[model samples]
Target: MASPGAAAAPRRGHSPLLLAAALLLALAPSPTTAAGRGVARECTYTLRVKTSCASPAARTSDAVAVAFGDAYRNEAHAARLPTTSGSRALERCGTDTFRLSGP
Candidate 1:
């Protein structure tokens, strides 16, 4: 027989599994977030003139250069320019002027 005035046992803390799951969720990266940790898409800048551009793909410089050539051609056509010519490089985004090559 049980005692009539006995107290109940204390509640236990959260389970280890639950805690681990929660920690994993908190540390997981969100798919919707933009990835800018490494190299980011930057606009190309030339001799104090900035142009809309992107860098060549890693380990595929030739292919990327060719792709950028097409892009530049399209841009020129849209701008009603006769032709476009320049070198590929990394530059800041949203910049309008091309930066000088050296100091």
Candidate 2:
């Protein structure tokens, strides 16, 4: 029988296993890992005629193009200017700025 007030023996190799698990967890991918996936980014478009447009948060560059087209069309309509085609607007309105950030 164990003596009263005697300390229990340390478990064999338990600490190492715990430490390895901790390391694995630390090295594992996080819930917010980007992993080359696209994130919401802001992009500005500038047209040849000095018309400027800003897009809403977009996940990919292609999405930015679509957003730009929509914004440009609305702005042009409001300004009583002719709306350009999506491809034409994209070609004319070169990207002024594009910034990437994590989710």
Candidate 3:
């Protein structure tokens, strides 16, 4: 028998511990990228702002903006900035109140 300090008895080809570890690593999967909270970050958290417009603002865009071959359309949306127009982006100061947008 080899002394306790000597090299461990050689196995046939592979060891059970190594096989088990390999199986565990293969089964226990991790995220490809650094996984964030299960919920998506861009999950439509409506941005809010307080402002006044001269009149009801209308949607208008100089150029056509399309994503994934889908053309965005504006219907009966009031508070939200249109697919073409934006509220927080267009907001500017005029006289007294902080203007969120213009009409």
Q: How many residue pairs clash in each candidate?
A: 7, 0, 0
Question: Candidate 2, which ten residues in sequence have the lowest lDDT sum?
Answer: 17-26
**lDDT, candidate 2, 32-61, per-residue tens:** 545456543232232322222322222112
Better of 2 and 3 by lDDT: 2
Q: How does each model score on lDDT?
A: 0.25, 0.28, 0.26
Candidates in descending TM-score order: 2, 3, 1
Name the TM-score of candidate 3. Answer: 0.15
Question: Which has the better TM-score: candidate 1, or candidate 2?
Answer: 2
Supply candidate 2's per-residue lDDT for 79: 28
Residues 1-103 of candidate 1: C-alpha lDDT, one tens digit per residue: 5588987654455221111001111122235444555532233323222333232222111211111122323221112111233533323222222221110
Return the lDDT, model 3, position 8: 79
The CA lDDT at 39 in model 3 is: 30
Identify the runs in model 2 with alpha carbons over 4 angstroms from their true place: 1-36, 50-103
